[model samples]
Target chain A: MGLAKRIIPCLDVDNGRVVKGVQFVDIRDAGDPVEIAKRYDQQGADELTFLDITATHDNRDTIVHVVEAVASQVFIPLTVGGGIRQLADIRRMLNAGADKVGINSAAISNPEFVREAAEKFGSQCIVVAIDAKRVSDQDEADKWEIFTHGGRKPTGIDAVEWAKKMVTYGGGEILLTSMDRDGTKSGFDLALTRAVSQAVNVPVIASGGVGELQDLTDGVKLGEADAVLAASIFHFGEHTVGEAKQQMARQGIEVRL
Target chain B: MRHVAVIDYGMGNLRSVSKALETVSESAEIHITSDPKHILDADHIVFPGVGAMRDCVSELRRLGLDDVIREASQTKPFLGICLGMQALLSYSEENNGVTALDIVPGQVRHFDTQRERSGNDFKVPHMGWNEVRQNISHPLWQKIDDASRFYFVHSFYVDPTDAGVIAGTSRYQHEFSAALSQENVFAVQFHPEKSQSAGLQLLKNFLNWDGQS
Candidate 1:
């Protein structure tokens, strides 16, 4: 009995409603985050993450209400990401019941914010979300660069080096997402995950490009991630968190099943 | 009327703690306070902390809650969590060695993943759910299976000088003290507030406990 690899289901919420398709399974009112969060909790999900993909300024406050409603009922750790720019945003999300906040573009713009946030709120709650994209193709040498603005904007910082720097700045966890495989169902960037995981001592969460149960297992076995986060497969009712854990357990990965 | 005061010394989130406790019982009053006077008035005190030991120590002294915690833990059902649990020890290796409350005779040591064999892909912060082997029977373990998994996130583990106080032990790079109990005070390395059903059950038992082993 040892530490089990965590299976996290990420919800991309837009304007307070879950922004994903509900065409897969028995889900009523796909926009209601509380109902979906409750369902995931019942499925024995290790943790739940809600990314506020909401863009409009007027609807920005909607995610807070959604977070507050979900936090009251769900007992596990909750993480809220997307648009976390300032320390006040972190406090607001935490006060609204989020256990951790993910900082993306803000960290790239001002690395000192990470150090300040970690000093104020502790590194356990400060997560540096790194969006990594391959700088070279499959046949060439493995190299990745940091991407921002939903993986649309590119930064010159090397993904591996940036991860190390973030950890130095008190980023307790690294949420590494492969821009190349994010929505393609191709699988996680194992090489990139390994590079970052090996370079730092903090927990690295492997996100993006999870197509099937095998991909989740590969994330832990190959990527060496402390946790695996997926959006589509689980959100669309194609697979449940319980089923994913079982699949990982069957593959000899220790999971809380 | 039972009241639980979750000590807030300018660190981490205390709402989840208060919220978890509130969910355990509606009749009991739960509030997060940095005031020592209000803390001592409560029936039970939950010391919840996160962040560096140096900061935790500095804040406790700055707010004069160190003495309050010592006094409160001696008489009531006091619960120390995460950084708070580490603070109960004499000192820690973090921040290049920081002196702690010295309540539980022990020295907090780092995981030292770089030096250890760490053949098992051992990582720092030891984050996530792991089985906690029960070393002694206690009220908090009520309705919870022995060796049950609890959520944890810390880089250091407690090494109590007095083995008798150890209630549970878990292994990462090596087996270390995961739970400690001395008189009326009980501390855990894991975040029971985030441990789900087993965690809530422990809190429920604490609400009903009378500080008697």
Candidate 2:
């Protein structure tokens, strides 16, 4: 059977409330996490991811409660990310009913932690999130560089190289988010997504800059991503998950409708 | 009230499986336990597992649940998921040839088909939703539609020796058994608990099924 391209609706949670922001700042509350997640589940979302944007010590417990509430109501797979610094943090999310734990800043800070988490809790449950930005003419030597701390600090690490390393280190999946395109609603960074998707042996999820249904199809076709993730379009009800899927099918892309 | 025992050897996600079973039944009792007595005495047993084969095999032997599982398979309705399905085989290529429960005569092998042959550079871990084509009529496939997509996350695939036991097949780079049915035992390589509507229907059907084929 051919694997169907997945449509994922991501929720950014801050202090127990589902929120949306532009480029990780200027946050605004969307709705309750559980309520939003249930709606996506009903709309035939293949999976749901909850990103704890706060990523602070005090807000950690809040994310756990949010994950628990959402998991109870939504039967689809749930991925929890943000502030997953250590094994304990990953354990906390999984114990709270998260099917997978996504590591971003923590993975960049300590790359070996990705392998450790993958080994401890099978690679199937470990997702490495890479936030990258394309370099301009000034840095001709590098096309893309890794960014940490919500795309604020830039590392010299190459995005494509980092993606290959994450997979070799046993990352089951890669969630590649483009800093240049995130929240812009332009479209996914097809060049970057294609490079990383070809570089890894696991599934790559193209995220950021998805404004229309065409972007979803482009992500799977041009970007070669196994899945496409978006927040604003789905959270605001611009297009339902069914509509996006119908558009994908019309474009000759296999999607579970 | 039918009591379903989800055999837990501390390997995979039991919460989602238990929660889904609870959602499917109003009067049935779902218990996640590693105790041998609870499994043997339960009306139905569901074996669920994930992670490495070496660890899974060791845990089952350490808890002495391997023998208990063997006995319960013959006495009641049994359902295995993911690694739990792999463990029912005779041996696995994973963990450098680990011996399994030998409940079913089969071997688990890694999907080594090259991309050049399939024309698609399919990734290993074969992670995501794929369609399961049913091969035979069974009670477990009751309300669920044929060729329904189920969520899968695994690197190895089981090849049962007897073709008669093969109940359903799925494609990766090539076709492999997705569901196996033998006597009172039925197992699947995908996670029905996470498959949404179609998966819920399968769980509900299992709750209402008897041990008979």
Q: Which tens-of-lDDT digit does each residue in A132-251 have in candidate 1?
A: 999987699889999887788898889999999999999989999999999999899898998888888889999989999899999999988889999888877888889999899998
Question: Native-contact recovery for every candidate?
Answer: 0.66, 0.65
Model 1 DockQ vs. reference: 0.65
DockQ of each: 0.65, 0.65
List TM-scores for all candidates, in order. Answer: 0.96, 0.96
Residue pairs with backbone atoms closer than 3 Å in model 2 (clashes): A1-B171
Total clashes for model 2: 1
Docking verdict class for candidate 1:
medium
Determine the iRMS, in angstroms, of model 1: 1.7
